[model samples]
Target: MRSLFKRCMSALACLLLALPAAAQPLPYHVDPDAREILPNLQPVPAIRFLTTADFPPFNFRDPGGELIGFNIDLARRICIEVNVACTIQAWPWDQAANALADNQGDALIAGLSMTPENGELYDFSSVYLALPGRFLTRAQAVEGFRAETLDGQKVSVRAGSAHEQFLIRYLPNIERMEFDDELEALEAVKSGSVAAFFGDAMRASFWLNDNLACCGFAGEPYFRPDLFGDGLSIAMPAGNDAVRHAIDWALVRLKQNGALDELYLRWFPVGFY
Candidate 1:
């Protein structure tokens, strides 16, 4: 009887030992001393970042099918500076907000726009890049293009994007076709199925310049303070103060040291402005 009691206690002890390991949350919180180290001496967590691989000049897969772009490069650099092991996991842009909210990844570093609605869903790092909305259409479709020009035209925009909201608010005359991603919108325009598409100017320019025969920038960019917000920011789960502070500090330091400018030049040799 004593032997059986000893065996039961040993089993209970083993279970107790395993419980803490399973219940422990990911170590997203940084040490106070680590912050003092600034860009260095910070222990990098082994983390995966979710991003939309289709958004180019910012984040996308190269000809070799490996992820490469400005955001991807910047994320890698940030990981290096913070001394963290990181990987970029491609996900649909529309799904990124939910993915991070669900804790599927540590953060979303895609060229995520900072809007009030999004702010309610996730915390954001400091703005890294400012982008404006632009129209994309075939060159032949460009003449006399205006908000009025969209009347009765089929327009494509990625669902859940600010451009879609802009269209619904201002250009109700146009028939808006919602897509799961900007790539799908671009494909519709390329295949001549959609009259025009709206997206970030940099993304539109990259696609138009690269896929010259199919599409081109149609008109000057449209900007509204309320709809677009300030610019693009890295997204983390709401209340992730540690990650936010780390990223904000990293951005400020990089900009101050001109590293951010060098990165911009490396990607946008002609300049985005």
Candidate 2:
């Protein structure tokens, strides 16, 4: 019975991925969603991944002191499919890139955006996740809201983030309050101090549903990949094609077999799509 239940769930997961195809366009800046994995390549014997637990549902730990979430589960699945050993350790969020750079880890798989500049420094797999931008406001204020309606209203955005740059380019007339981080900006909205908060749709979805329920989605999710770059991909030091290809191959297998969709549904029951 348990095996049958698992099979049914897997079948439904694949259906969910296909059902949303037309309604939701793929979030990518580049054409061709995935690269073809090279044939007959050997995966490295071992891998140590560096990631952070600060982001919930994506890479945070559980109450049982177990490291679990989308990235953690996907990372383990990738290693399993490729038949390689991999370890994920929760390090300080800021240290993931450097740890991979310094060889302290083999891959960095927290929610990382893929960009050409980073491409110069690291070989990135196809995006396993793409988080679009969302606007959140008090429920009463959410109806019929548009970017133009925000003119002169206090809007909160994370300083030095893509969302902040987006407002500068598109919503220039709004009053911008730059917060040091996402929680601060969202809190401003929760307190009614700011009219709205602009942030990653995934985080905003999780936050509004779980932590701060006073706010709701203000508008459609924005998927301007030119502004946000490609979705989050795993990163390895530049020129390491073997490990890179191995992980990418695993991603392709995961998607084709529906494990990726299962993880997505598990974490994002109220997903942006």
Candidate 3:
């Protein structure tokens, strides 16, 4: 399950490759109608967000050793929306959760899994981003690629992954060629060894932009929150309703006013959606 939070650690490469996809629409996870009515605090408490710097595009250090990424930017935006003082700090991934539990930070925005066990320990803000499974196929094969149409066709996936399990559970008819990692599975598609490959959209987007010039995304992205798990949410100390509610309310406002979409486009120029 921890694999859900695993991400490529090449923030600089991703940033260099990111190109504006102004022609495509961005994905929205927050509902515009979702609003919170919380008791107003005369002086709202400051929020300190804890994160790790290894996950590229989400949280990572730039060339100057300054922490910067999508999550950092979003955390600041949430603070701005709620009119609260905010500070972001990066810790080693292994120690981040323990630090949060030790009262080192008010919230964690380091892609914490919203699992039942964690739900008991932390109050999670509404899911801010959900990664989807997508198919990457050779340019020519994309013309008529359809999930239903690929009944017995060969497709590559990482061995024993959630993506592999998803294929086994849903598209059982397809002949799966499992690889030990995403790059191998993608390579099978690039070399025409398989008709397509299925895996995490974010990683695939990075590869599509950086390597694997032979393939492109095919069909709409598949969203199985039950299988993929809730994508990404800010985790706060359990029962911290004030902070949680404020962040949730700010997320809704961010989506409604287009600030969130702007950030999405800026970070994910080749958007997974």
Candidate 4:
């Protein structure tokens, strides 16, 4: 797994400092177009971020067994913004959540998507990245493609993914062909067996980096928060509002200074937004 900051640290630093530091454009991925500043947000007294390193680009272990990834970078930066010593430890995903709950960890820094049920057990910081829905079609397809125009086209989606369920519920008019995996679905599109592949925007974009000989995104990203959950966030145990709020404050500081976008682009060079 490639560590976003480790791979692009110098480039990201240059990108952030290109302009007068005060007037840089805050990078917002899409829709809710502005980053919500948490005025009342505050940080915990100390910072110890618990995480799992299986999710690459976001969180993963390097070949040296060192913890390194976007989430790891984000966690360290947040601690620096809060002016505290920070320690990150990798645990099993389930244990990370438990560690936070048991007070063994101060925060959980995995790629956790916000959900209603999880909301009851934990509080989360504002989103750092959204896993949106996107369409993959032949590069030569018509311009100005839109959902309304997909009515008669054959689109493939993983049989039971959230994207598939979203297609069934929201864009029922389009002809959806279910496949067992996104790779197979994408292959179908490549073979001209299907007009497009509909799925997770991040995965699809990454897929295109290596296999886009015949395809590209067909439309603007679909960010149905209802279907995709609420994006990746810092999950802190419920009732730990101080820690949650503090992380939120740190996020705002990072975003305002362009550090957030730097990390974002480093990890997601082939971004949908």
Candidate 5:
């Protein structure tokens, strides 16, 4: 699943850093002029959103056992935009897809892969978020880091990861050190054994702020949808045009009105891009 749910660690600390405003622009954008015409104001009487409790910051349970996360808030806002009641339920990740397929839910926002295989079975909304690749370097080396000058330098990456494939394809000049996991790669950077650790930007952001004070982002986030796949999107049963149009229409408005950016900032304080 090369999605955020798979790459991200349980960094409640990153969620805690949610702030009132973001210092940078949000990653996802929608053209204000683009529009989707729905047949009626209320596309559905109510939307039953299916998600999972295991993916933190995106969808997870709060200390009070209440379902809470960026996805939860976004689903509520979507319901408001469509002028319909919203009912969200947390299901086991393995069953969420089948539940949606069986008409048990109106939408699935649990980081389902937006791949060709899934596209045949479900209709997807516009990409709401993308987990970008990034370079994490020691804090002292971040001041003037240059991707072009990384030739012959040791850069750590997780073995068999999309990020590693990206590094091999685009930046083949650098020395690659493959690790079993991102933590090992990050540790290599912290220990000065590598020039940088290349992997998911969101995870890098969390590690940078949570406890790895010795490092920081070294360059702009790398967006390679072809390699990493198109990011988080809401999925619905195939041919469900009404619901799909309603969600897409609402998403554009949310992005234009800055509501989406606000949600992004509130959830991811240390912006990955």
Candidate 6:
């Protein structure tokens, strides 16, 4: 009876110890050398990714109600390569940023650009694409255009965007009308509520070709080094080294395998950047 009691106590202690280890979150990293030799090494589990579904050509909800776009497709591919299930949640762009900050999602796969202000709040993956900004105006608005054509003209831009920051710093005298999304900004331009709308060249081209019957690029493409960073990248909340590493590795693999190039061609056949 004494021996059996001692054996039972020992088994309970071992089970208690193992329980804690099993309940703990998986470590993000493993020793590379050991992992290389151990084929059975497990990866960190998948976490949800949040994005705004309004940005077309990057992430948008299709008529079929599926989240479908370049970024969405790329993120799904990356998750597959990493052997994790990725859940995409659509929220407003600003709400998505807040959700990422609050740890509601593992990362933001929207067409997020790496800017100094944003970098202060989050970690960023290597750039996936480089696109220039363009100015769109009604064809009649360009009739008497000069170097300072946009001066004093009401311009619509997405609030808190790189274009907004650029205009604030460089074109301070211009009347600025900020919108929550590009579609809204385009609407403001189309309705004559604003004289012009400034955004990515690809997006502007998309709008002009698809939506705006009388609007087109008014001037040469603008590339400001200080305002727009090298290109757009995926964003993860600050100090998320594990998630960042996995995403970076997956992106590099996609680029190397010609998947990214193929995606660009398929989405933007006319070419961007």
Candidate with maximal TM-score:
3
Better of 1 and 6 by TM-score: 6
- lDDT of every model, 2 decimals: 0.68, 0.74, 0.83, 0.74, 0.83, 0.68
Of the two candidates 2 and 3, the one with more favorable TM-score, higher being better, is: 3
Report the CA-based lDDT of candidate 5 relative to the real structure: 0.83
For candidate 1, lDDT tens digit of each residue in 81-193? 66678888988867887888998987798766676788788888767776668788876777677767779999999898888999988888899999986767888988889
Q: List, residue by residue over 131-231, the lDDT tens digit for candidate 4.
A: 77888888888377777777888989989788899888888888999988667798898899988888887767556655546788787777888877777
- Give the C-alpha miss distance for residue 113 in model 4, angstroms: 3.7
For model 6, residues 1-273, the per-residue Cα lDDT tens digits are 112223233333233223322111111121233211111214447847888866765676555667777788788887886777788889887688889999999889886667788889999877677667777777787555542667888999989988898788878989999988677798787788988888776655555544435776666566675666566678999998777777777776666566776666555533434
Superposed model 5: Cα runs more than 4 Å off: 1-22
TM-score of 6: 0.57
Score residue 268 of candidate 3 by CA lDDT.
Answer: 77
Error of 5 at 231 (Å): 0.6
Clashing pairs in 1: 44-84
For 24-71, candidate 3 gives per-residue lDDT tens digits of 657788765665664364445788999998787888777678887889
Candidate 4, residue 36: the lDDT equals 49
Residue-by-residue lDDT tens digits, candidate 5, 1-273: 334444553446245544444486577657656866654655578889999988877888766678888899999999888788889999999999999999999999989998889989999998889888989888888888888789999999999999999988889999999998778788899889999999988877666655446888887888889887778899999998888888998898788787888888888777888
Where does candidate 4 clash, by residue pair? 42-245, 42-246, 43-246
Off by over 4 Å in 3: 1-18, 211-213
Q: What's the TM-score of every candidate structure?
A: 0.55, 0.70, 0.92, 0.82, 0.91, 0.57
lDDT over C-alpha atoms for residue 149 of model 2: 89
Pitting candidate 3 against candidate 6, the one with the higher TM-score is: 3
Candidate 2 structure quality by residue, lDDT tens digits, 1-273: 112222233333333334432223233222346565544445488778888866655566555566766788888998888887888888877787888888888899876656667777888877777668989898888889887889999999999988999999999999999998677798899898999999888666655544434768787888778876667788899987788878888888788777887777665655664
Error of 3 at 36 (Å): 3.0
